[model samples]
Target chain A: MPTFADRLAEAVRQKGPLCVGIDPRWESLPKAIRDPLRDELPEERAAIGYFEFGRKVLELVRPFSGVVKPQAAFFEQIGPNGMEMLQLLLREARLLGFVTVLDAKRGDIASTATAYADAAFAGCTVDGDSFPVWDADALTVNPYLGRDAVEPFLTAAKKADRGTFVLVRTSNPGAGLFQDLVCNGQPVYRHVAAEVANWNAPTRGACGLGDVGAVVGATHPKELAELRAAMPDVWLLVPGYGAQGGTAADVKVAYRPDGLGAIVNSSRGVTFPFHPDDPDWEAKIVAAAQKAAAELKP
Target chain B: MPTFADRLAEAVRQKGPLCVGIDPRWESLPKAIRDPLRDELPEERAAIGYFEFGRKVLELVRPFSGVVKPQAAFFEQIGPNGMEMLQLLLREARLLGFVTVLDAKRGDIASTATAYADAAFAGCTVDGDSFPVWDADALTVNPYLGRDAVEPFLTAAKKADRGTFVLVRTSNPGAGLFQDLVCNGQPVYRHVAAEVANWNAPTRGACGLGDVGAVVGATHPKELAELRAAMPDVWLLVPGYGAQGGTAADVKVAYRPDGLGAIVNSSRGVTFPFHPDDPDWEAKIVAAAQKAAAELKP
Candidate 1:
């Protein structure tokens, strides 16, 4: 099986570097979607609404997007039923031939890390039986626990032929509070970038990028470009491109000159492209996705 | 409602500093307990077995322990069914007057962080309907995403009168890989320690401690004492007491002179006290909890 980097590269080549983010906020969803969330305590109705939106979005973006990043917290917010919906939607996205990045940001160490990897990728295990749980092609990881914490997830991704994006320099306003603090006369994110490159080096696919990737905020174009130079052969998953005040030009430097090193994500900016009252909400979502895809063209 | 700091201080004063960890590893369960895992899929049998072990452990430790730290990854490995079991265990512990700390290590930014805080402390919401998911008294947070990542959690915790423990120096060997790096002429964790104090300062309860706490490993005795003084008003949730090899004397310095600053944790040491084959395993678990409580009595 081809690694996630290879698959992602193929997707990018076919559909440009656009990856739709399925972050279904309740208030952002149109009434048609939100009306069905009036179910009982189990959130069965809400789960259906959430999955329906994602299912529709997957279909809408299938022609324009190569990958989809579903924010786990959003689905997880609706409870286990919502998680059930997440699993179903992810499986649907995979079946539709989109490389799915489950935005879980899970981090831990040793066996704990292994358990999370199991739940995220290969599935859960019982006495002697293994059950497929969240079938994500890739996952977002936090590297706070160091090498041991990240190694298990990497190993699991290798086994499953999937991938991971390590949070390097996040896009939020307060990200620099700690990530940009000087360490060895450089920001701390630089050290993490070095480690991410080290982790990626051992397993480069035919695309020259490894299953290991880094998430450098598109909002920080200067840092993104610096990190891009610092860590070649690393696939960058750039967020904050649209909704988070990052322009297409700001993210241009994150890509290789040949335009194959990065994938730009526009979540709400593209997905929730209309006011809730817009009767043409679904049409707007599709139009927005197409425009965003074009804007991120390499 | 009283703040988590006030409640935790009272619990410690009543039952000493011992916080029993309910980390139910499926492989670690006795043969009798693991016998019921013959169900098809959905991890129903496995969830039941995990919950059974946890229920027994909670009963065994309830009398001697002031608090319980349930490692979320263990339960999460079993999938949503396991998460449901986690909610039940946490609720049971809360009903029995235990200060439950969900060791989730979750971190994110903006609304994503809010969703996680909701899942951890309050509950998942759908429109106006709130599903009581975890209902933990407090949660362990990963601070790698900086202040914004942590602020939503702090806000949600305050709303629920709950609390948070930010990871400073973890108990694992590889924790120092990034945490100990010299940043601005000091170890990186020192910077994190300062921020934890900054976060803690605003929420000081009558006990002279705040709802925002720091998790400094008991293994690093010198660092523990230094962090204690550096964040005097911040409560310390010290792991690495028994199984991780931090001796009683090593963690003695983690506490204030008046014995009110820290709570020592012993997961496997207290929870998994005997070999699975031991006939008197339950008694041994109780004895271990009692011994650990005495050791951490300060």
Candidate 2:
């Protein structure tokens, strides 16, 4: 099996850099989808809707996108059944040749972190064959506990041939309140970016990007450029495009000159299509995402 | 409903300052316990063994400890069945009169964070009357995503009268590498500590502690003092007391002179009996924990 970095790089090359986000926003689905869900309980609606929508999304974007980032919170909101559906969705995505990134921002002490890595990547079964269904190719991780906490994920990823994207700079408005704080004349996020690069050094893929990646928000264009420069070998998973107020131009700096180093994610922008009176929401989303990808093309 | 601060304060007064961590390390259980689990599948053993051990732990510790911190990753490792057992264990802890701290360390963007908080503290049901059990009284949260990510937990916590402990100065060796970075000539964690105080101010209990709390490692005695001083209103959850190499003296600074402001945690130290020769591990654990609590008594 090709490493996550190699797979992601190959996808970007084939799909012109578009990575669709499978957000499964219940309220945003078409009325045909929403009407049936209205009668079901919130939990049932979310679970069934998420599975149906997620599978449709995978099929819809399979021809146009390289990877699919599933927001874990949406699935988790519906309870364990939703999680079961998420597992099935991940399997479907893998079958469709899309790299799966499970967006679970989990961080803990070393021992617990190891357990989380085992849960997300390596099967938890003692025999390994009859494990849980949903093991993503990559996962989003929180780096708050510093290097020791993150080391377990790295070790697990190395052993499992999986990948992790550490939160260095987020796209949310309040992110700058702490993440952008300058410590000794260098931003805290910059320090995290440097660490991400260092962690990825030994795991550099055939494409030169490392298995360990950094999540640098597209909303911070200047920081995106600087972080990209700082972590040349690290794959950048940039969120906050479209609905998060980031333009395609804002995300351009995240990619390498060759356009193979970054995967820009748009969650609500692609998933929620019932914003106004747009007749063909799905087609519009596909076009918008393709356009965004085109704008970021090298 | 009593706020988390009020409940915690009352518990502390009733059962000393010891907060036992219910980490069901698979390797540490007795031969009778391990013998049944040795050949069973991981999922089956995790479901049966973990629930049985955890239920017994809750029953045993309820009379002595104020709170039981069930590490989420341990149960999560076994998949959906493991999660079901976690819910059962949480229910058992509450039934036995011990406050449950779900040590998930989850942090994410806005909407997602709300779902996690709801799943852990507030029950969400689907089709049947049976809902996913909200077993925890409080939860451990990661602060990497900044204030927005944390606000959802705080919102739900205030509404449900629950609480959260944000990761601040951790016990691990590499904690200072990122947390201690001098941002604008002040350590980053100090800023987080201040925010914790501010967040807790609105939910202060009669005992002068806030519902919002900070997780500070007891190993850093000096920083613990400084963090204690910085976040006077916030309850401090001090980990790193035993196996992580922190003593009663090291944790003393976290509490006020009245011994009313902090809860020091010891997981493996209290749970895993030192002498295999001891006939009863439960009795040994209770005695050792009682001794530790007495040493910390003001």
Each candidate's chain A: what TM-score?
Answer: 0.97, 0.93
Candidate 1, lDDT over the whole model: 0.87
Model 2, A1-298: lDDT tens digits are 7888998899989886666787765556666655677687676777787888788777766766778899877676666667778888999999888888989888877788888888889867553335753588898998878999999999988898999999999988789877988887788898898889899999988998889999988888888899888999899899988888888888887778777899988766666645524557678667666666666575
Tens digits of lDDT, candidate 2, B123-164: 664433335545489999988788998999999888878999
True contacts kept of 2: 0.59
TM-score of each: 0.97, 0.93
Regions of model 2 farther than 4 Å from truth: A29-45, A125-133, A275-296, B37-41, B125-135, B274-279
How far in Å is the alpha carbon of B77 misplaced in model 2?
A: 1.4
Candidate 1 lDDT, tens digit per residue, A1-298? 8878999999999998888988987777788877645554446767788888899999988888989999988877777677778889989998999999999899987888988888888987665678877879899999887888899999999898888999999998899877887877878899999999999998799989888999999888899999999999999999999989999889989888767889889899888988877889889988998888888887
Query: Over the stretch B144-262, how does candidate 1's per-residue lDDT look in tens digits?
Result: 98999999999999999999999999877788878888987888899999999999999999999999999988888889989988999999999988878899999989888778989
Pairs of residues clashing in candidate 2: A183-B183
Candidate 2 overall Cα lDDT vs. reference? 0.81
Q: What does the interface RMSD come to for each candidate? A: 1.6, 2.6
